[model samples]
Target chain A: MADSDELFSGLYQAVLSGDEDGAARLATRALDSGHSALETIERALIPGIREAGDLWEEGEYFLPELVTAAQAMKAAMAVLQPVLGAEAKSLSLGRVVIATVEGDIHDIGKSLVATMLSANGFEVIDEGAGVPVSRLIERAREVDADLVCASALLTTTMPRQRELVNAVRSAGLRAKVMVGGAPVTRGWAEQIGADGHADNALSAVNVARTLVGHRAAG
Target chain B: MEGLRPKLEMFTGEEADRVIDHALGVLSKVGFLVENGDAKALLREAGIEEKGARFHPPEAAVRQALGTVPARVCLFDRDGALAADLGGDRVHFDPGSAAIHILDPGTKRRRPPVTRDLCHLAWVTQACKNIAAQSTALVPSDVPESFGDRFRLHVALLNSKKPIVTGTFGTDAFDVMKRMLVAVRGSEKALTERPLAVFDCCPTAPLTWSELTCQALVDCARSAIPAELVSMPMGGATAPVTLREMVVQHCAESLSGVLIHQLACPGAPLIWGGSPAAFDMRHGTTPMGAIETMMVDLGNAQVGKRLGLPTHAYMGMSDAKVLDWQNGMESGIGAILAALSGINMISGPGMLDFETTQSLEKLVLDDQVCGMALRLSRGISLDSAGEAVELIRELTVLGNFLGHRHTRASFRREQFLPSRLVDRATHDDWEASGGADARDRAEGEVRGILARGNPAPPADDLGRDLDELIRAEARRLGIEALPEV
Candidate 1:
């Protein structure tokens, strides 16, 4: 095999194995050998992350493994972004501000959705737990976010999610609002006049993409 | 005692002692936040010092609490018959409590269970022989949120005759439930003598006791009702990552509960129980079927036994959302391990999806699993003087004992006869019988049981009285009637 072919194969293997340092080194080597950054990403990094997602759906890989693989891909992206300035702008998906609503301390569901969104190439700003409605809207406006996701685990705290939607509407923010949790249902979302709802993390990514009109990259 | 009593031990003697010492150290040095003012006063009287919200109780106070708690708690049925003696190696099974949804067999969809669903659950629980007790399994979504717990208890008391394992939403609801029990048992004294239910009170994980749960604990102790302290620590989430460290945290939380219960009323019956599970990193949910969760339960049971208290643990459940092979495997493994561990009063049999959903078919299927676990716990019995040796010698020459007296006498004792739900037929026979899986057979069984109705329904006047009481409580809560399905 040629030197560039060997280098691309090495980078693929590194991302697949969730080796961050190895992925970084291989990306640097491929670039040093005069290989185009976009070609390397299209041929190696994207395919590696896609394969990892497939493994996750097949139950062969779990969240930790998927997160580490995404980290490896991000490590390589860190090395390639500056070189392909105009192409990097095209790579951006959309920005999302996610949080567990006020008076609720549970954040696992929200954090999982954020991770899945990030893995799918979205810019996720996690505001953490017990975030008030005004703060979430303020942060969404500050980041020029495309969507705001709110989660609540308890029945008493579910009304806060509806309040968040109302807050966004009253503030005249353009960001679409999505709501979810153990107690939140599609009916509740529609009743609250939110934009979208998802039952789990995997579907949350698709819902967010659809809400923002960003089709997933092949 | 006709059967063998097996025990599952996870920690050595030194290891157990070390864990207890570490728990005591946590109580004395690190302390825990007491959110209830009444609880703080009781702990202060017991020599616990308070600094802001945190209270530091010495080891001697915990030891005194342990000494005052009863070693055995006896639960009685509605007829005042002893149903379960939660002591020693005696183990019992009950369905899980507080499921939000029921997986409907007809639609195969998850929906919020109503009051009628709870009544049907009580009826099904009554029909299952292996299930020793009943629970307020589903939270009725039709009732007012404040009246959910009380309404569950009222429905259970009217529908089933077995003793119940239940809990309250807060102190006021606990008081109302006590009145309901009094109305059923005829008086407060009668109810106290033969308590028809044991209250489950939980302390927050990582050593925090909330105000409402603390108040409930104290009320249960003062009322002479048996209180089971459920300290649920989610491993790798609210608790330490390692099973051993989780066990230590469980010990500290349970120990703190005992101290508060004993301080309220010395010599009250107290049980050490928990529903701990390892948090799944992938799904972000606690998987009850994980082996590490079982290990934590076993370790906590061992520590409770060492302290000479009745033990309980949540097991015999599955994380699978449906009743498939995964459900069978996970429920079977959990049931067998909990039975072998000799944990008193194991919960979570009919639960699925990490205890969020309940299914009637799964409850019927778990009956067979519990029967098999009970059979395994029975071990081998020597019937006669030279039963084994002489029977072998006599059958050795014949090569068959179908007609022998020994065969007739010992077959029932030696072998377990499973129900129709368990497949024992040959391949062609099973195929000829429509090739139904366990779930299908269980569904049929459930329909048959529900069709027959409850064998011992409450008297008409008593039922009317109970309904009136529930309605009156709803009226007090500013609701006219419960929502109809």
Candidate 2:
């Protein structure tokens, strides 16, 4: 059997190269070799994705590379998720339920934010686009979500973001609300009683981490 | 006396008809979900049938509405002086309104704007010669949320002499706002005779008009006040994915609004205006600066012009978060395009961050951009061609036009002399003058204008009445004092 150092590095390399199959294999191997699921994720998968994020930030990597690296990280998590189970919930930065508000069909920004949160070790439940405020709150309650991220692409639909905030607060859920979109501003977010607002996907992640009191992963 | 004015047409005659045809079809088939009772009754009078909470105006209704709409809208200053003519090839500019944050010049941080910020905005706008009107640009946080709409207009009226481009947040604010305007004009009849503000009434994208905004539209039309139809269609999101289709959606929405307004009061003045953006798929943001967004705006305006109506567009703004190169490039391009298209009352200067924030410095800088754009739209003049040939012949051997009488007489008319914010100095001279960037220079300009004090405050009695109105409203909201300007 390979040493612990070799197993972690192999997993890291697989994730960095966006080799989903290799990432799953190495994760399984690490788990079988007696390393904890948390350790496998922390020591390899998180670092790999963090490096990819860094590379993207520094202009060394583009979007496609970043997305693929995230895919590989997700593959490794798929293996760790069942084994880790309830404990894996603690390993996540936070649980986020994200969606594009109802009556607005825009989804690219919300999807990007969801993918980014997932890549950064946050448990993300993406509701896709045109999700009603009630469903969003219901899902947040179901998951005991740490944050509810709502995106609205139109001035008409922005009222729904406010509705989401009101619904969450009325239900007495602990989840914080975050809103974003083309027409959304920090002021609008604050005015609507949302906990936070981000203008772009990267900022959304940062804002999410800040709201949940989580330090940057890796 | 007519110089060859430059023009930009985004649609051919047939293309415009195609857009209008589709828009009419959408109104007849897809329909708009209008929630206002008065608007519904008006549409019902115009042969529009309400089907399942949506009003579908037939083509004849749309055509009849279009025919009744005044081809021009005139705005007056607070002093009842004619300020702007929204008609044929006359372009005016106002700062984008309703931004919630102000980029504080001292800290360079964006914070919730207060009364002082709004006053400062008015002062600088008054001093900007190229900016033709004032906007209720900042939503002051100190006031109650419901009072924001009229409070902004009140502050603007007291601080600046220019006509305002403003809107209402609550349906109740409309009458209070109209009363304030009446106070300024000395009576309701005078206010109606010379409208001092153009209220923006936005229709939600994908054929929806909210109750609040629709009520504002009906109120404006019935009151004989001009309403600017701000149809905002974020392409591929609230609107169709295709650019042309986005323009079609914008027209359909605005056309439905026109039918409601004209049916309420025929011959009512309205500007077929919009704030549509091209959806940037990669970023999931509506980029106002994108060329495609400009195309949608121009195309929308082209349709308005084709129908013999005045037009407005939310152009000359940037989505950049700061006063940077991106801001300059985007704003400059939008200004030129809007001007070349001959859009009347272009409504976006001093806007940044997706129209969420306003900067005093950017306002001063965009004033120069607007000046240059207005000059560009004037095009080159063959009117001066014969005189130029004579000057050249007279100075053939001297090679010195600088000292010539013709050069001295015509230089101001021939060239657009930009402000100091535009750096045309020698590199060494620029270095000697502090080596400041555009933002730094703009900061200085804003400071200089503010230091000059309010250029056009209202008369003392009028100002007092306006203040009392706002104070009473604040008192009603359980507020004791307003922030000092």
User: What TM-score, computed on C-alpha atoms, does each candidate reach?
Assistant: 0.67, 0.68
- In order, the Cα lDDT scores of the candidates are 0.85, 0.87
Residue A164 in model 1: shift from native, Å?
Answer: 84
lDDT of 2 by residue, B1-485 (tens): 65778999988899999999999999999999988888887777666788999888889989988999999888899888898999898999999877999888788779999988999999999988889899999999998888788788888988999999999999998988998999999887898889899899999988988999999999999989999999999988999979889989999999988988888899988999999998889999888899999999999999999999999999999988889889999999999999999999998889998889999999999999999998898888776766776767887653334324455455666777778899975454466679999899999988888898888877889889998988888787777767775
Taking chain B only, the TM-score of every model is 0.96, 0.98
| Model 1 misplacement above 4 A | A1-218, B1-4, B483-485
Docking class of 2: incorrect
Error of 2 at A77 (Å): 93
True contacts kept of each: 0.00, 0.00
fnat, candidate 1? 0.00
What TM-score, to 2 decimal places, does chain A of model 2 have?
0.89
Can you write out model 1's per-residue Cα lDDT over B150-208, one digit (the tens) per residue? Answer: 88999888778989999888567987888888877888899888889988999998889
Docking class of 1: incorrect
lDDT at A197, model 1: 90
Model 2 stretches with alpha carbons more than 4 Å out: A1-218
- Model 2 steric clash total: 0
